[model samples]
Target: MRVLMVSWEYPPVIVGGLGRHVHHLAIDLAGMGHEVTVITRRPSGTDSLTHPTTDERSDGVRVIAVAEDPHEFRFGTDMMSWTLAMGHSFVRAGLRVLAGDQETAWVPDVVHAHDWLVAHPAITLAEFFDVPLVATIHATEAGRHSGWVSGSTNRQVHSVEWWLANEADALITCSESMRDEVNRLFGPEEIQVIHNGIDVDTWPFAPRPQTAGPAELLFAGRLEYEKGVQDLLAALPRVRRTHPGTTLTIAGTGTQLDWLMETARKHKVTRSVRFVGALDHNALVAAMQRCAAIVLPSRYEPFGIVALEAAATGIPLVVSTAGGLGEAVDDGMSGFTFQPADVAGIATAIRKTLDDPAAAAVRARRARDRLTEDFSWREVAERTEGVYLAAKRRVRHAYGRPTIIERPLPERDPGK
Candidate 1:
């Protein structure tokens, strides 16, 4: 099957798990003999002049990184407008790439769009090609804001998301929790739940030495408010009481970094809480090995890929039973679990791991053992392939043949 993937983020420009999800999915799909073409943006600090809309193959996948349009746009300041410009740029790039060299277009059997960011291009390209559009709603704006579409920005994003959900022929969610959320909100005819997967070999089990000076706890993922990083910091003061030398190291960057740092200061755990900023894959895996345990205290995680990464690394996990995290890391059996935003609960769970390092190691081992059956990339790829087939079938049966209408074009030539 030839598949066209649309996404806003990829490696080197990764904002969160969506980038990693698309990268791995495309690679594994290609490995399975599927022709995978990813349409994404060039990394920041580069443009069409320098970057020049690259079309290269990486790890068995054809990646076409489109340079942004030369416009007066700043992502942080002009988020919604930036997103609109990005989607239009993506549409143009997608058409350019699909209209292959020498008038031989490399048309895909299906167009798979990831998240709301690339919705416009996804819908447009799918319609232009008269193919099925499969959208994976990574997370909703309402979900991120905890069911409140407050403010103009939130409402605008939510509206686009709703439009995308309705337009797509088939919809997929990264978790069962997310499937439910989409069903409740959009009332989509059907939504498939495919949990995010990770490569176990990449994250080998190398336990941190039990004998430590200060117990090191790690919090990864975006530092956004919904991620519960602030809540994790709030729990640090109490965690220090149990293990006086316990230190917290935060990995990953977000809008909440300054606020979280201030949160630690206010809690008087500034000395203990250390923000290491964002670390690359090698550095992140290394950090995982060096830490005593990994704490992912997300308040509204759709599906915690980091939890799977932690499990793959054989690190003891203390995750809140928020959204799909509950499925990723089982309470007590695999790792300890707590309710979201419960500072006392978070501290108690951390202290439990610190109290008995041996017991925590046992749980960590169990978590690692669960990865093969639950979170393997091979399984994820196979499941996703099934979805692609189903989406095609839906297009064929439900919609029959897409009506092809060729509109006459009037040439705008001054010479003529």
Candidate 2:
């Protein structure tokens, strides 16, 4: 299969799990003998003149990156316009690839879109090439806000997500919980659940040594309200009451950094809390090796891929049973799980993980064992391949793919 993947974030510009998810999946798919191509943006600060737009990775994936337009538009303040510009860049790069030498012209059998961010280009490429568009709704705007689309930007993003979900030939999500959320919020339809994967070998099992001073608890991923890091902060004082030397190291960065710092000061746990901001993946893995346990207190996680990475490294996990996290860590069986945003519950789970060394080690072992069967990239790619085939079958039944459709946008109520 000649698979063309569309994602806003990719290697060297990873903001979250979506970039890593696409990175691993594409490489694995190519390893399995599929011709994989990824269209993404050049790293944040550089342009095409500074960085090579076409990267032929040794892992058998061809990456064609685009430079943001030389405009005075900031993504934060001008998202709609920024997204349009990015989409235009992606389409241009894709068309260049498709319109190469007649003898070496490249064509993709399917266009797989990562999230709503790349929906415009994915839909355009799929339609222009007459191929199936398989979209993965990583998360939804409504889901992030706990079923509320309040701001104008929120509503705009939600509408685009709906358009992508409805327009795609087949839909996929990172978890069963997310599949339900997508169907409920968008429209009733079948959406495949493919949990985000990790490279188990890259994350070798590194059991923490017993010679510890303060009990170190690490929280990875972006620092945001929906991430429930604040809840973790709320539970810290309670955790320290029993384990006085317990320290919480907050990794990653987001809009809530200042607020989270203030919250720690408010809780009087500032001395014990360390804000290390964002670190590269290698550094994060090394810190994972040193920490007592990886804590992910996500209030609305579609699927906690970081937890899987922690599990793969044989690190004990204390996560919340929000969305796919419940499936990722099987409570007592694989690390520990508490309800989302449960302050008291968060304290208890951490205590439980620290209270028993033998039990936690056993659970960590169980998690590591589950990696091959559950979270391996090989398994994820195979499952994704199945989805591609299913999407193609759906398109075939719909009277085949059309090379071109010069139809105008249908009139509809935006509020609906």
Against the hidden reference, what TM-scores do the models get?
Answer: 0.92, 0.92
Candidate 2 lDDT score at position 67? 80
Alpha-carbon runs more than 4 Å astray in model 1: 101-103, 393-416
Q: Give the per-residue lDDT digits (tens) of candidate 1, residues 1-416.
A: 99999999987578888999999999999999999999999875567798778888899998888998887777888888888888898888887777757666898899999988888889888888888899999998888866767566777787788878878888999888899998877768689888889888888889758685888899888878788888888898898887988988999898877878887888898888888888888999988888889998998999999999988887899999988899888888888999998999999999998888899999999988887788888888999999899885244333223222232323311211
- For model 2, residues 71-123, the per-residue Cα lDDT tens digits are 66668788887888889989988888764778868888999999988989999
Error of 2 at 399 (Å): 18
Q: Positional deviation of 128 in candidate 1, in angstroms?
A: 0.7
> How far in Å is the alpha carbon of 374 misplaced in model 1?
1.3
The TM-score that candidate 1 achieves is: 0.92
